[model samples]
Target chain A: MTSCSGTVLLSRITAGIPHSAAYDDLPYTRGGAVDRDAVGALVQSAADGDAAAWKALVDGLSPLVWSVVRAHRLSDADAHEVYQTAWFRFAQHLDRIREPHKAGSWLASTARHECLKVIKSTRRLTPTDDPQVLDGISEDRTPEESLIESEEAAAEAERIRRMWQEFEELGDRCRELLRVLMASPPPSYQEVSGALGIAVGSIGPLRQRCLRRLRARLVARGVR
Target chain B: MNDNVGNDSFDEAAQDDALEEALRRAAAILDPVPAELRHLAVEAYALHSLRDLDARLAELTFDSLVDALPVRGADVPRMLTFSTGDLTVDIEVTAEGLTGQVLPPQPARIEILGTAQPTATGTVTADEMGRFLCDLLLTGPFALRLRTDEEVVVTEWLRV
Candidate 1:
């Protein structure tokens, strides 16, 4: 869970990095397992306004949010708005998120809705010079193909869900730390340092420790 | 079927590792939010409390909050059951407080435990899409008494 313990250090370290990277990489997803129990712990903590919990929640679901936005074919500006909107909405519903396992899907749906709204609003405002823009808005996949693709996606999502059940045993800290470490381009040294509150130099060691811990936990649980 | 997977290739560790890689690929399909929007998510969540000030102001705040939620749908399950282990008991439920489509594995059965009076009994089947249909009769506390071909799996009592 993200606490104020790293706030000052995070502020200082993250100050140097350009914010552009946040948009550059895709969202991080835990491929092994999700450790929903740890997620539940963070959710309970976040309900009380724990900053680490907030960060954990964001790290956990950021990819889901991003995926939903992309599915809508929104531009970076529109996608950003939708992403922010999804997190904001997540806060309000945190207390009501009864099922931690479905959190990804929930976040994904919210991001999609926000992106659609943004696109609609943007279309109303921006003058479309390109005929392609108008065509894109009206284009739709064949219903049969859409159904097949939707089913395929749904099955794959279910498989991931099962994987998360195994991942839920690792503690919250490992989940959060490993998630950042696994993030594409490795969430920069400073970002990782600030997010996890480890000293910049200690991040490599901390990451190794976290991975070892997760491996042990997974092995103990008969996961992998 | 189990033998066909191959002893060397289908080891538990190998399956686990393969599943891990699969999850990574699955997550890749999901779109990511831009950095600026992430900052906004932080800001919006921080301001969630401020929405209580006034009704008119609350409306704007509520709109913003609604916008900030990470996912949205007209309707989705409030709870999702990833998997229920083998049934030594009667049956297992995977979700609560939902309408529209429900998904569960096929050939659902309840496992009966040691001489206990079987309170719940039913046939819940998954459709072609792996969705299920059954009325959630138990309100406050519920349990699954399932008897699969292999084992009887009973879920702990839950408050739905």
Candidate 2:
């Protein structure tokens, strides 16, 4: 296996920083490259007033934290509030964290709590008797809308679940290619081609072939 | 009844797009930080640095101590034991989450448990079986609370 060492470059344009530092600075860096120990140290440093370390931590983990906020079904305004508030709370309690490695889960839970609170508050503000409020706030509770959201979320989750099961059905090369496809924002074609040692021209064809295998596997499992 | 059922099915089929749209609307609610908010995070970190590390550390230690005390349960006698000396709490766990709370002899003070990072809390209570159970989202070792109207009782640590 190739070592996942080196900096994750966030963009083609560099501000002239070292590659490792640039990679560490990017949000979408490879998962394996993240060092929890370093993150812990950085957090401690930030607690001690290190501005640069704090900025680096925020830049790197904001995307992951924000993704959790979105998944909680918070309104955009509410989500932003939760995101900002959670960070504030995190800063206040940094030294209290015993297991620094679990910072991700902490951020996730805090965001979820804030989102739920917002949703509940919004629910409470609905006027039960006022005719004007009813007219303004009234949304048709179509049975169809409820069913569709449930079905789609379930179907999407199931599809991803079955895709993993079928991934094991493919040969090693197909697995490797598909893994790259699953990566966030995905690797550039040149990067994927280089990693797999395949001709640049052939990369597209190989991807289609791998996806076909995946589809076939899912079809066999009776998944639409 | 048959005609009504048929009509309902048709309406359901027609409403598929409505559902998709609702889901899209819900998903659109996610709001990430604007580019300018980056500066706020920097400033917050700088302000955090001015506090005394030892003082902050001591507060954390006190927080953990509060978390270590046990609550008594109604049904279970000695069901929820929060003993700082034991360094462990015995509780049953399942896939759904932790299922019990500490019921103390009296309504004792309850504080958040686990490390300061990603910490969570529950009230202290024990069941008739002298059992208090809690389901935590994070699975691992955690600290508990000591609660009494008169004095707080904290445990050393417990694993879930």
Candidate 3:
């Protein structure tokens, strides 16, 4: 798989040395960028055994995966399991990815599939897509909130905690949509649609509605 | 009137954008991807090396948990099937361990792949009947790598 050449190329790229005049064409050069073309290039390089390219790919797309898993409201352990499984499968199939440019969409779909499997395996009822039905489900504090306590300032942390309390009041569907939309570097609507199994055209309107609902809740509590 | 209406909608969108931006920032701090998970994902890249280039991936065709209806009040075992056109592996995962058969009934060596461990957590060999049993119950993400006389086949990764 040209492992030697890939290593040489990656080392040169990583060392800030131009391997060729087409240095811009090197995938690792665009480290942490999450565009379709950049993703495709990283996938190719990773498949060729470039570790840097693989790390870049994971760094860029892990948030999308995390967001998708959290959207299913799985327990932290289950979510971690699903996250690992999705990335593991993706790693196994890295060479065979038909559309490397759509890696974000692929990871999102895989995460969603794994989440459903966990839900079904645990005998939990499948979450309804209807936002109204989702409104009835109550949420418990996630482990992340507790983790945030040590890292944030006192008043700021309190405000964030209050904001999250309101955020939890959102319906499942709204929460899911917003969660995916909130991914770091932000995912494109195409990726969000793929992640949520919603129409691309509907994302804007849905996101608008979800945000409005979250804002109203936050405002009522004087936390916004 | 149309201009005013358009401006109103734009303003609403802008407001939504502002609120979403704030929430996104907060969610980043509140629910950032755990560092360990990202590290694990990066480590997964090592799973497929040049030596595994020829190994056929057995795609997961069926999983009882995802495809079959639940039988109430029963401790139903999770069933999984993976295939690669010519080869098939069917597994039943119970509380105690895993039992599975490599179809076409030929002896083979199987390595249980677990994400937690850098290497295969365990190895078991199938008998002439292509059936094998492992008494060690598995947890977390796992897969099976089968090494037959002719070729190597790896199953889809799953959380057991």
Q: Which has the greatest DockQ?
A: 3
lDDT of 2 at A203: 68
Listed in order, the DockQ scores are 0.10, 0.10, 0.41
Given candidate 3, what's the lDDT at residue A223? 85
Residue range A135-216, candidate 2, lDDT tens digits: 2212333322332366675465444334444653467577555543333223345434433445668866676666666666
Interface RMSD (Å) of candidate 3: 6.7
lDDT of 3 by residue, A148-197 (tens): 45645446556766776677668888988988987755688878977889
Candidate 2 CAPRI assessment class: incorrect
B90-129 per-residue lDDT for model 1 (tens digits): 1222344222122233343432111112243444543444
Q: Check candidate 3 and list the clashing pairs.
A: none
How would you encode candidate 3's per-residue C-alpha lDDT over B1-160 as one tens digit per residue? Answer: 1356587788878888777666655555556677799999988987866337778999999988767886665568988999997899999999989999999989999999899874668999999999999987888999899999999999988886
The parts of candidate 1 lying over 4 Å away from their true place are A1-31, A115-224, B1-33, B53-160
Per-residue alpha-carbon lDDT of model 1 for A1-224, expressed as tens digits? 34653343234323333332212233333222344455566666666667666676665556545544543445555555556556655665666677754555566555545555555434433221223322221233222223235666445444443334443344555544554444432334544453444577876655556555655655675644
Deviating ranges (above 4 Å) for candidate 2 = A1-33, A124-224, B1-33, B52-160
In the range B1-160, model 2's lDDT, one tens digit per residue, is 1356587655643443233222222221212234444455444453346433322111122221124453343222212333333222334344444443333323434443543332346555554433454454534334445344444444433332
